[model samples]
Target chain A: MSTATETPAQHGLAAHSHGAGTKSVKGALDRFASFDVADHSVPHGREEEWRFVPMSRLRGLHDDAALDGSDYTVAVDVDPRVTATSVGADDSRKGSSTYVPVDRPSARAWAAAEKTFTVDIPRDEIIERPSVIRLTGTSADRGAAGHLVITAGRHSKSVVVIEYDGSSSFVENVEVVAEDGAELTVVAVQDWADDAVHLAHHHVHVGRDATVKHAVITFGGDLVRNGTTLNYAGPGGDATLLGLYYADAGQFIENRLVVDHNTPNAKSDVEYKGALQGKSAHAVWVGDVLIRKEATGINTYELNRNLVLTDGARADSVPNLEIETGEIEGAGHASATGRFDDEQLFYLRARGIPEDLARKLVVRGFFASLINRIGVPEIKDRLMTTVERELAVAEELAAEAAGDA
Target chain B: MSTLEIRDLHVSVETENGPVQILHGVNLTVNSGQTHAIMGPNGSGKSTLAYALAGHPKYTVTSGSLTLDGEDLLEMTPDERARAGMFLAMQYPVEVPGVSVSNFLRSAKTAIDGEAPKLRTWVKDVKTAMDNLRIDPEFSERDLNTGFSGGEKKRHEILQLELLNPTFAVLDETDSGLDIDALRIVSDGVNRFSSGGDKGVLLITHYTRILRYIKPDFVHVFVGGKVAEEGGPELAEKLEEHGYADYVGEGAAV
Candidate 1:
């Protein structure tokens, strides 16, 4: 029941001030003055989705030094059929493409300074090779923020891969638009170093008859939060969101996804799988689907599954479906968080397979079906690399567990 | 000589109804270079015998001694049993989705031998084994038993047997769900693995179809979780002709 026009102070900004700022920050503050970032605040452990996540790890004060020029770099690999362009927040000709600054006197101060980068795909273009954006951040003292915007023209087909790696803690925001008759695939891989803390927010808009597939792989980071929101604006549009995460000892990864089926004949499917090992390793998967009153004949399904590898490790999974209209075609959601299946493990071990290798095999098998659904080869390769690395880490942790036992 | 001996093996499983005995007073022995076939009706503890021998956790031995080549088998863990030269071709092989068959076989080989296999020899040996089993070389790259058809899973099990080269193997009803062609191929792989002098096999099955390919030196009929009858390969033909009606009657009395 909350409107977008509500003021930040009204939504829990009493702790901070909307003081005077630079012209650019002032404009954003004025435009979104009624928007309350606290509306999005989910108190740690109080919300079911954040139960197993170590939010305390990210609640401490972060260094605010600006990143040095050499500390961050952006590289892109695009298909021959598609052209890539980097547009800053000031680009005006691209209507409705203005970047929203995260830092300001607003309630969303924790996410401040996160900027958006934009990419445009022309009409009728079929991008065969996946476009890869590699962001390498090497700052040791200061945090960084980056933004991305992707637009697929009508009847166009394209793939985009965004890789995030840096030394410092930071936040990122990505926005994607798929016009009518367009098909887009966006794959994000976060392979930051062990010391880095990353928070990413992704917003996607799907037009009529458009198709969008978004996949994320998280294997590295001390603490990471990747949030995705998909809004189907036009009827007959389809959206799919898939994610895989592996976190070992001392690593915390949280994923939150919302699919808003606002129009009729729209379909959305989401599947996220994760594995956690080590003493304090933790993971969370939150899947929310909203079927509005006008969205009749909607088909929405979501599934979240997590595997806990050790005794102290934890996983939280929440799949919620809100159906405003009972006229939908089909809607369902499922959530499961469980320790490794001992019966399955024994079944494998009985085959003469070692216990360690057997557990790894089962975990890999659990994610293979979803990984195969990723049509892009580059993204698939990247996912495999992340999976292998996580498996290696799991093995090391298992060895340590054995040593302790 | 390599041999697997089970001395008065009694196995039970923990269930909601409390502990229920599955195998009661079972004893058998299979010497090196010999094939032994065990046949029984469903619920007669055929699978339990196999699982107990493989050291499955669910089957706890109340009283038993399993030894492989004079080494205490029950004293070691399942992995240790495999490393100690005991292999189990599972009745229902678990599907491993992400690990490739090649990777799984290599890891098993390394674990068994306590060292990594020489890459060149390992690859050659794997390729030869795959060729012998009529399996496509590309299958090695596929996930272990993931998405495999019933026949393909059985063939993959045989491939493991061929690659691991354990001294003693327990083939647990591998021909259950296979078509005739797949059954023949799987039987061929088992026969190939048993061709060497140091290999021993305890083949457990409900049907006598597999025995037509790999003849058994001895056939034992299991009833009431105990060996009710023991004879040469002729006993298999006798059971195939006449079902386990008489055995069931005798088991009821006992």
Candidate 2:
């Protein structure tokens, strides 16, 4: 895969079907890429990518504000086969995945960070327990820049979970590389406080015959945007990307992802589910899959589902699939945004479950399958507890809206 | 003994045009230790009566007095009505994905009993009930009604009828889509519930096949939202022979 996009017009795929005029003029992959912040321009709300996001809520992460705040602390707990350390920007392994920043906030985050947190899994070792990393922001008064790199050696298997909480205006760029025959799982949970603003970009490079499972759980934060890019480094590379998010009243959560199938005999599956409640609760999901001319016998499917609980709550889902070659096995995409199912609620309530508890059960069931597929036992229970707490708050907000109406 | 009295009940459902009345001044009484079979042709409002009795939001009781032992049932929500000893085995049970059958049953039992059941006895009771119904033990772990066949869904409804043990059960076309074996199994389960000798049953169906298994003391022929004729079990046998042509006109008989 080419790392530089000096002549993006010539490099972009031509005449592909999806995201025609909604995203950038070209395909999603041909977007300007660079490490220097000056190369990318600040986005106004009118831009297709920024249309769904409120630019004012970014806290100047996209513009000239300094991202040098140190009001945060990081803690890491790793399995015996893994090592966690911080390296200077000049570390040889920093950009080993050959991924450059795609957006202004991503570029700014890369240019502003002096050090990167790195996690390494040695070759041929199977990790028994997942490595856990926790980053907590002490205050939201100032913004911060963050960078992380996770590399899995050949034939090894490991799971890494990074959890974020507290409050801050944070921008981050994450790079993941899996070597041949490696199996890697990475989960990034954004559980920030209601006052926090977060913008993150995750670029994953899948190696030959390797498998990677990546999940993002976004439940809190005043405004959060997560953009992920998946690139296949060799044939038979398989990637499963899953996400679960809930946006409450006055909150904005957006997830944008693209999968580039530039290699043959590769597979990719993306599924994201979200629920929104209360006034002005907004959740947006944009999924793009591109099957290049060289990507033959490839199989890919992407699905997005959103449930809107009450009036004035909105969910936007857009799925685009572009296949330049018909020689691939199969390619399909489905997107659905629907209101809370009244028939399911009535069924539960008629079975002697009270209305409130019935609603809770429906919402819980909505996120259960996705959470179970995360496959991390330690985090599953904690995630369910968090879901219940969020449901309590959502119910209160719904009741308040009902009373006002 | 408990008595459910539906006196001159009227119901209407909202459509795109306006409110269309489905049930017009229907009267019936179900007493403990007695089974009343309400046989009707298609679109005769038999299902509407079941839903209205269970307080489904889609049906409006424009004017009616629905009472269980002299207490107004219209004032209660669906859950409260279940706690008051009323159950409706829906013909088309909605599938609730990601909620296991075991959890859903336990929750409904808790709500009806006002407390959680003893874990030991509850598990044993559920196991015994499921075993009698010939349901696989692993079925309890699967999502409720999701991907279930027609027979499995009907059997699950009967299982709830046996476990919840409500005072009155309104079985709405429970025998509609079942084969002979499944029909017999579901009827046996219903008979087990009614065999307690203190439960009232209002069995609603378009056919008399299930009446042969669980005989009803009274048979009411429903036509055009009201009872066209009322008699003993002999009425069901007669309808089986003539097929409702005597009541609904030869042109309308199925």
Candidate 3:
């Protein structure tokens, strides 16, 4: 993996060249320069983690700038107790905020156009209730991009839901931080309107003894790429990543997750499940866990399971574990992808369930185990509704195929 | 007349031994509001009969004619058969993980009845049915058969039978895994459905304990995919008392 550090001049970007309104851009550039971006783009296929991912997807995105703002209206059906506060550029510094600029010029320009949003759970405040933060883009003429930063303070616990719903094809980056002794549950639902292209990056940092549970549900967009990276920075910290995704009829959804155990006694559990249907619908899940040598007492496990709903659709799953030390209590990973089980289908059908309903039943059941793990009734209910809606769409597509046949 | 007529029913399944015939030349008639018990040893094709009647794709009826109330039953799909007033309370009910029993039952009722039942009436009906079976109303919210005890699964099957109100029900060994109390509750559910005066039941079982609660009007000993003996409910008692030793010889003959 190339870890080369590139100066702004090498990338053909002059400092403060974009004009007066670009002060945030300059600050972003200064902050991002401290991190290694060139090495992050290493297309190393020798490692098992990047074996199945089509690195070619990153081809045209290398020099893309931040997308411009679109006339999109975000639709939100959230709990009444939860407020959707929009954090404009002026309000960014009021709370604990971390910012990372995109290396690509296009993503940088897009982020510069749309104001950033921040969701904050006050310090030491425990809101046993759940809340949602929805972002919708409606730009039809051009691509869009923005940044979301969330913070959970010390001794505080709460659930935050972030949904991206819109008509624009764009890129998104979300960075989150959980301070010491804080607990945060974040659910991201990406159900963009058709004709949208999206690439999203989620970076999470868990402080010492803190806990973060994150889940992603993807069911829309033309070409969607979701990348999540979590670093357990504090001792005794834990992170759990659970995701459910479904694609059908010409939709493509790809997810890549990397969990880094940087501190000792840090634990991580990752489970992602998905289903694909219709002709040429593709669903992919790539999970990688790296247990650093110094993280001796770290315990981690990951599992990715995919179900193919049709003969023409395909699912790809890759789960990798790199353990530097074996002193951990337990560590393992499993990945499997296959078509529907005939035995299970027959089992339901034999009970007087129609083939269509039986298929829906089985697919719902496949995700039931994960839904139970969500631990939030509001989010769980919404997940069920979204899953059922997707199934309904799949059935319609299947009916059309049958009609064509 | 409410009658389940199976004429020259032949069924086969694809197995390691190639296409194996499980049901051969089976013939039977079950009348309305009457209980009929089918007793057979393991691998005697009792469950195959249930699957065939329920239109399971694996149980291909190569040569058979099944009619319910004079309508061609075998010609319909499983869901269509269910809508046509046939219910199969499976011996091993499938564990549907996410679908609650209440939701599944409501959907099944809508499918069978061709319309959604009224909310007020539906709730009242379900509550009354659950009360009669001595089942907690909270069971309705639980996922269908998912993590349910064996006895709970049996009771759930009966709950479906009562709520769906099918004209003819094929209970495929509903008593196989039930204990004494569970057997009584399950039998009580079946009795409530049968007492409706418009329903007919075909109870398949290996034990006669359930029959003690929901008495059968007729008993047919199924062996080698054929009814080897037919008698009154006394045959069930006889099998329970003396075992199937005397009938196995006759069952082996064509």
Candidate 4:
């Protein structure tokens, strides 16, 4: 249960996506070189990069449609030490220092965002509490666009949380930069109202000897497709990307990550776990890691595990590792998707636990390891309560199915 | 006094060929304050009897009657059976990862007893029990049986027997993978469970070494899915010396 912030030195650095036993498409990152909307066209289902996504569900996010209406809003809560400023096109944090859009949706969203919300940690400043940014979208039947840029000054440390709620079609780009020797923890909590659709491009760059912890937690949404890319600016940098998601009926949650090991002696560990229940609940996790020939002594391992809790729920996990020079440290990836373990159920039931309770215990235990690793106590408590609520709904569905039989 | 009565129990399991019979007309009775050891050779359906009694779904009791204190045990689920004072120490214990031993034991205790254990005394009880079984205190923090050695798993079984304290327990080869020290420790735990003169034990094994520590009042030689010979402690010594070669052939009285 040791968290990324606690042992930041190990399980650190680089970004990636991997397929367990199949060849992974490496062109996704290559296509990410341009921020101009004209450079990246709308994706059709035929392309390898856009096949799994339901293009119609994007709600015109990919067609360069004008972001209409003003139903969604952002609320910032932070200490005075950290400043949240509204910057323009000439802002210092803009330009190539940030990530280029890999798809039409991101490019259009970036172009449409009139104001870029920027949060900066003062040089060598340490903030004790995490800053919270709440994005609440009204069910106004309109699409909205936004952009956020977060940067940590030299030798500074802080946690920034971006939470999404309510219902609307939303597309945004978030860029994070950790300066040399700085530590940053960015938590993206997408607990949206059920009808919400969010497409986000999250890019993070870690500096020399710096550590960055990124957490992606998604529970509610019609569709949430997150592509989070990581790259190290200097050697000895560390990046730990953690993700947890739960998808229910008619919900789709996808996490695509690319951790680039371009700097020597940098390390990274990627762990993403998800659960799916109810009819048509789908979860997809794609982990790809690319290590350059000069990136020697890189210790990186990516893993994705999914638990399918009921009938008609699907979990797809792919972990791919591409290493140019195998001479440095160990590099590997693994992914697994399975239903509840029968042997574990039997063991619990044989010891006097009822079937429903046993199933809940098994699932809770399956995710408990990662849940316990979260650094924030309030978030941890809230997640557990949410998990219990989901289990209760699962129990009702199971009872109904049994009754129909 | 409580009593577990099994009569003419016939059991079968589903396979590729469909429903292969495993138990054929086996009869046994265990009363309070009694220790009965059922010894058998390999493929003699010994484990099947234990699993059948525990109400495993795979092993269907095709024809039989089982009762506990005049109550129909066959109608109850496995958890209900456990709550009704029946315990089975499995031959191969299943591992539960990410679930700490402390939480697991307390969960079972709470479920069976229908109440949460008192935190202070329950912790003490678990610590003392683990100490008596020679288990490290850190074991309580580890996942249940995951990566545990054979001896540790066996001792953990006995540990449950001691803590759960069921009126009747069927120990299936609890001595198979133990060193001398672990064997004595586990047997001692079992002896402590039945020492009150109010519990019953149905110890199943192929070897006689465990009998030295937990003496059985009755010994039954099982073959071809049923008991072929029944006697006292001396029968165990006889079988240990003569072996079960004579019990496997046809025309051997059931």
TM-score versus the correct structure, for each prediction? 0.76, 0.83, 0.74, 0.81
Interface RMSD of 1: 2.3
**Residue-level error in angstroms, candidate 4, position B46:** 5.0
- Candidate 4 structure, TM-score to reference: 0.81
lDDT per residue (tens digit) for residues A182-283 in model 2: 999999999999999999999999999999999999999999999999998899999999999988989999999989899999999999999888889999
Q: CAPRI verdict on model 3?
A: acceptable
Question: Which tens-of-lDDT digit does each residue in B1-254 have in candidate 4?
Answer: 78999999999987888999888988999997999999999888899999888888888999989989989989999889999999999989988766889989999999999999999999999999999999999999888898999989999999999999999999999999788898899999999999956999999999999999999999998898888899999999998898888787841444
Better of 1 and 2 by DockQ: 2
Q: A1-405 in candidate 4: lDDT tens per residue?
A: 122223323332223322421133345334456768888867877777677788888777778556755787789999899998778855767643358777788887777877788988998998978898888998738778888899999999898988999997888889999999999988899999888999998998989999998889998899999999998999999999999999898898999998888899898989898888899998889888877767887788888888887799988887766655545666766788888887788778888888877777788887776666557665777877887787777778888889999
* TM-score pick, better of 1 and 4: 4
Question: Model 2: what is its DockQ?
Answer: 0.49
lDDT of 2 at B70: 96
Cand. 1 TM to true fold = 0.76
lDDT of 3 by residue, A21-117 (tens): 1343333223232133442344344544345444454333434433555656554443444344556754553223233433342234324534666
What's the C-alpha lDDT at position A58 in model 1? Answer: 56
Q: What lDDT is reached at residue A43 by model 2?
A: 87
DockQ of every candidate: 0.32, 0.49, 0.26, 0.47
The 10-residue segment of model 3 chain A with minimum total lDDT is A1-10
Most accurate candidate by DockQ: 2
lDDT of 3 by residue, B46-83 (tens): 99999899887777888979998899988898888887
In candidate 2, residue A338 scores what lDDT?
Answer: 86
